[model samples]
Target: MAKTKKSARATLPPSIGKVLKRLHHPLDVILLCVRWYVAYSLSLRNLEEMMAERGLEVDHSSVHRWVIKLVPLFEKAFRKHKRPVGKSWRMDETYVKVRGQWKYLYRAVDKAGNTVDFLLRAHRDKAAARRYFEKAIDRNGEPETITVDKSGANLAALEALNADRPTPIKVRQSKYLNNVVEQDHRAIKRIIKPMMGFKDFRCARIILAGIEVMHMIRKGQMQDDGIARNPAEKFYSIII
Candidate 1:
């Protein structure tokens, strides 16, 4: 009787039980939609139509709700298992439109082109750059060197951080060295271009994070414990 009772329990991971508790759809179905949305360039309506063809009637609004609710959790989980990046860094900022206004997305990649961290801010000044550096350093530890383009704000931010450190970080300003990171931005920009722009800042931040997480997964950034076979498997592995 004990063996039968144990076997009858749901096989879903306990960590996500509370998150998906009230959802009517099966776990695989919900996660598939979320994964497809972020990993590919599919919109909510596109996912809705795809699911409909599979004989399931899921609305686009519900999928949007799922993304808004679950993506942050997915990001949190991904961070815990993210692999350490190289010490030499390349940092840059890109433009993201939120509410018809341009916001700055600060992103960094290691010397090997692995993503270090990303932050979105409303401004492109020294203060915004400093905050992004602080967040990245807090999560990823100090880098030996950071190469940036001829951005005064980025230079100022690194200078401010160096002031508080015992060993100063080497700062290099070269448009050519930063080309790797600038080229990396295209993968993210390509996915978001179809959406035109984000409706609000909060949504933009969350969705952008989801996209980054997927990008990281594609680059084999997550420490998968040797269990996942591909990017999709690696993505689903993070939640468990």
Candidate 2:
């Protein structure tokens, strides 16, 4: 069984569990499906086979259903637990395939690796960039200068924001500056593959948000526990 911490809600909205439990498969089965898929980054089919090995027969479609429905719920709960990103944000987007179609997910992370904002969209056009900016930058009060991978849409949005602002949003672009966000993404890619080819923007959003939170936890970036030890002790603890 995967380790689970009770969310603040104590229970997910009844509507979420009610619908999933209505299916013939039990909630434990569904939880097992979600945990394996999210925690281990197993694909839908892989989840099916893993469960079957333990004598629990399930189909990929059921696996997908479990994920698709629960993603938003997880997204909702995950946000409440994320640490503050504060300022100095780096942003980027990657293309992924979903059912043979392409979509974009724009994400930003602060200097300390805290995820700043994430948006899932069908396209990576100027308009999409604007939408992300209006919601992302506007809500948090402006961060100083923004760094992004070279994308004209990003430049356009930053330019527009600057022009509209009396101070002009400080804007800077550099190829190397985006390495942190890219490294963070690689950590996520190492785990999941359905995202190796995303089927839709919605799925991308759900999966990426969960990943950001997980990454922080694994790296010991959340609140510190004050456990101090020599490097050798830490190494053995991790290996064991």
Candidate 3:
């Protein structure tokens, strides 16, 4: 029983497990590959060569496909199981290049740190900002308050979207409130710097969504073990 417990402790994150079951890959093979790559920041070719030593034959590209396809699926299903976000919202944007020109991605986060919505647009003007808020409100209804940076876009966005509300929208501008969303973007920067930028906005959006899902998990705002609390920390009751 002790040996069995130690053996079970060696499995990768459950994301790798569900992904393997869904893709019909051998569990040991998939988990081993994922763990090897994540633990050491190895490339697929490196992972493939390492696995080959263990008598599991596979290609670098196949490993890449498995990680890209399944990790996000697991993360998405993981995020959907969370509690609803709070009634306050924070908003921000980051820049990316699309096709040869620069574009902007507008993002919104609820008070509980869940990414409520995002929009990648060619411009960052009043119209684009208004549309991003419009899209989020269309899905989530209006929050009690909206916090953003002192952007004309955000100002116009609230003016456009809350025109019919009884009190309209209270648009407050603050550097600190917007910091949460800005910091949320650092993970994307970390991941993308390794990839040397995305090929297109469509692909970038998918990659961003996957990264955000992972972020939500780390921030204690999303999960799948019947709660959004961190999956890594287990409390062992200590009795004197």
Candidate 4:
């Protein structure tokens, strides 16, 4: 009998494995589409034209599907690599229209201009503010100080949360102090403005996640190098 040799098998990371099934396009091509979609303000139609110019025939709907399906995977992979945010944070809420109805987008950023987190809500009251604050703290840990405008809802939420802590987090109500996070909103706003508005809330949330992840990547907040030498490779390496 001939001797039998054993062969080693390659494994895919869970994050990428889930998305690899039923994916027909090459990994590089998929990554390029995703990168352009999120990293730039290009619309789906624009991406379709650009891909056509490159000798690749892909529909805008396909690009939209890629963004919807892959963004969560990318965000999960990138979360493991994010740098610890600064101790102080600036928090604010902005309005976004979904299906012609206005919704609140609660966003927070550290003093260094790195995004902490964001949430979409139907209201901008104390309950909504508390929910946003709780989610941000849970994800990024509690900040030493939070700067906000004198929104009563925000102040109330801080007070409610502080009541339970042995050492309360400081809240600074100053319009000037929160300029960093306020200005940080422009990147996301610019992306959304081009699309006019999302058709539904779920779709809005999914797309927003992808957009924010791209913003974080561009800001050099998602890698050990503090800057991705090759973004495509860096993104692809997350799963492979």
Candidate 5:
């Protein structure tokens, strides 16, 4: 019998081998840099200085690359372990500056403050709303009811989605009802404010993903025993 070749992803452990290959630093050090950058409101230069204090002479650019490259790996590994969020969702959009240009950041959180999903778009129209809803539903499943602000664009998007699917999702448009997601944006905004602004959209998206993942961890959204010494260590165990 002929032997079947194993796919690269299956052969490697959790896709880290591909990203970490040729790196001289230890996995723990690399993970530390990533964790600090994501979990704290620190700039790349601040992280570099912190690493230097620990006797690691890594550049800020290296830390930037680690975040941009490794965050998706961590997110992909952690998704299967994420606890299922509530079917009732609160949806909202916030504006963020990227390279002096404003972009709409669409975010959805369940009733319990668990982040469902997020999308970045250049506009806040019906098309953008529809795309955001589609991505959120595709990842977290369709919500039983979605609470949003009194935006006609959001209403149209939900209606369009309901028209195509067998299971219709109820839409509620009340500012008070959607406060959960609105409040959730503050953590991200606080972090972004220190950086002045992102240089480009790609970097903004990557950094935002890292920041959101860190927020999810803090909220206990990722699967972990309460016995770990710390959150960063708990995350390290899952990835490695």
Candidate 6:
């Protein structure tokens, strides 16, 4: 019996099987719930009803738990397969309400509208800007130039980073040139608007990262191994 159990465990997909161990629902159902929640402007109860219509009795809270648990893993997998973005970055911050308080979501996109990286911070200041820049550069490599909308904090952060580098990055303060990233924020805001607001900071951070991963997949940022996949399929492919 132990040998049989060992064989069964070995047969399961390493990441998915381990991450989903002892879960109640089938993997597909859980993944479907998470993808729909992040990819659309649907609330938790809204997802509950949708699942019910299909004869599944998943609770709204359960779906929420699944999102919190699984989105980070999906984001990790997506980053590994992410395509290379351009070096000219347009960086900005947008507001997201958490527990009735507004928080800043720092985001950036390359010259071709490809996602660079994102970070959610309590305040929009030089420290937060520097953290976001460091994270972005660490993951996607340093950009040749970064365009911002005259935000002193963002410019200051770049300056601080440049002081330590032999080749400094060019910083451009131009709202006009940043129109692409500004408009790109609408897509993320649209999906989260229906949620009204997050109840806590951690929830907001993880879910926002998931949302960004979906948005990146929609923008064709994931390398598909030479096979074409729709946005939804691409999302599942991240884990499967």
The lDDT for every candidate, in the order shown, is: 0.87, 0.66, 0.63, 0.82, 0.83, 0.91
lDDT (Cα, tens digit) per residue for candidate 6, span 108-178: 99989999999999998999999999999999998899999999999999999999999999999999999
Whole-model lDDT, model 4: 0.82
Which residue segments of model 6 deviate by more than 4 Å?
Answer: 1-12
Which model, 2 or 5, shows the larger lDDT?
Answer: 5
Better of 2 and 4 by TM-score: 4
The worst-scoring run of ten residues by lDDT in candidate 4 lies at 1-10
Q: After superposition on all CA atoms, what RMSD does each candidate show versus the true structure?
A: 3.5, 6.3, 6.9, 5.7, 5.9, 3.7
- lDDT at position 104, candidate 6: 98
Per-model TM-score versus the true fold: 0.93, 0.76, 0.67, 0.89, 0.90, 0.94
Can you list the residue pairs that collide in candidate 5?
A: none
Compared with the true structure, what per-residue lDDT tens digits does model 1 show for residues 1-240?
A: 112222322544565666677777766678888888887888788899999999999998888777877899899989999999999999999999998989999999998999999999999999999999999999999899999999999999999999999999999999999999999999999888766788989988998999999999999898868563788877877764
Q: Which has the higher TM-score value, candidate number 3 or candidate number 6?
A: 6
lDDT value, candidate 5, whole model = 0.83
Tens-place lDDT per residue, model 5, 138-200, is 888878999999999999999999999897998899999888888899988987777778898
lDDT (C-alpha) at residue 33 in model 6: 95
Clash totals in order: 0, 5, 0, 0, 0, 0
User: Which candidate number maximizes TM-score?
Assistant: 6
lDDT per residue as tens, model 3, 1-240: 112322433453465444445554464465456434433335567777887888878887777666566545554455346446667999988887766667788887886667777777878998999888888777667788889998887788788777867877778899887888888767656654444455677656665565555455455554345433333321000000
Ranking by TM-score: 6, 1, 5, 4, 2, 3
Task: Tell me the TM-score of model 4.
Answer: 0.89
lDDT of 6: 0.91
Error of 3 at 148 (Å): 1.5
Whole-model lDDT, model 1: 0.87
Ranking 3 against 4 by lDDT, winner: 4
